[model samples]
Target: MSEQPPSDCFICRKHRGEISIPGGAIYADDLVYVGHAQIREGQTIAYLGYLMVEPKRHVPDLAALTDEEARALMILVTRLSRALKATENAERVYLFVIGENVHHVHIHVVARYAGAPKEYWGARVDEWPAAPRGGTQEMEAICARLRVYLQKESG
Candidate 1:
């Protein structure tokens, strides 16, 4: 069983269904939740195929994950990366676990498309202005495709 999250924790609130995220949940189990990254307020659209893999438990960082949780997290991250490449036609996927902003153990699974400039590689993949982007409708559609792909993959 997981411990209760503090009221101020964003991931906790998100897991509790208090926070709204775009594309909803692509996949989830007892240990991890996979979903598209959220679109911030006032932003017309967000970079498509950007995803977040987060622990269901309210752990602060990687050091806090149990062995089982760690295993589950990494497996899901790897699978999601595969999903992005297959379903999104991504040339590469960038994994980032910077906990500076949210303090939660969330991994950013960013997709890098083919023909992308070297300047937009790594942590700057989302900064590519010409990258595929979408609002809620496109996000929902993309997530649906991903959900179906992952479901079939798991089967």
Candidate 2:
């Protein structure tokens, strides 16, 4: 789509630096951006290592991505997943692209650590009672470690 994202697009606003998300920006390039997910309103703590990877453009879904954009996005996703494994000691990295709520092409790069039960596999990994949960300081620390790992393993 040649048209720009609407003025109210949350992802677009974030790309423009209007919205300050937790951990700030982990990585960014001409086509892709990687950052920790924002804490929902009223939530005191967030699931640690929940990252969002999206294109710089305001594409609505994967189908809207140009070839180059798609390539960059997936490559970064792979790298971020690896970073999670290395930095967070995550046993498994889950990738999700549910666009129903935000209408943005954002991928959820979730970390599933060891000792997580089978019932908590997939999207429910964060629901495990013992899952790693943290506040802003914790989020920032984990993001800092991930940033270093990603930079060292630069693509």
lDDT of 1 by residue, 27-52 (tens): 88889998888786688898998998
Q: Mind giving the per-residue lDDT tens digits that candidate 2 earns over 130-151?
A: 9899988898998899889988
Model 1: per-residue Cα lDDT at residue 50: 93
Tell me the spans in candidate 1 whose CA falls farther than 4 Å from its real position: 1-5
Q: Which candidate is the best by lDDT?
A: 2
Off by over 4 Å in 2: 1-4
Lowest summed lDDT window (length 10), candidate 1? 1-10
Which candidate achieves the best TM-score against the true structure?
A: 2
How large an RMSD does model 2 have? 2.4
C-alpha lDDT of all candidate models, in order? 0.87, 0.88
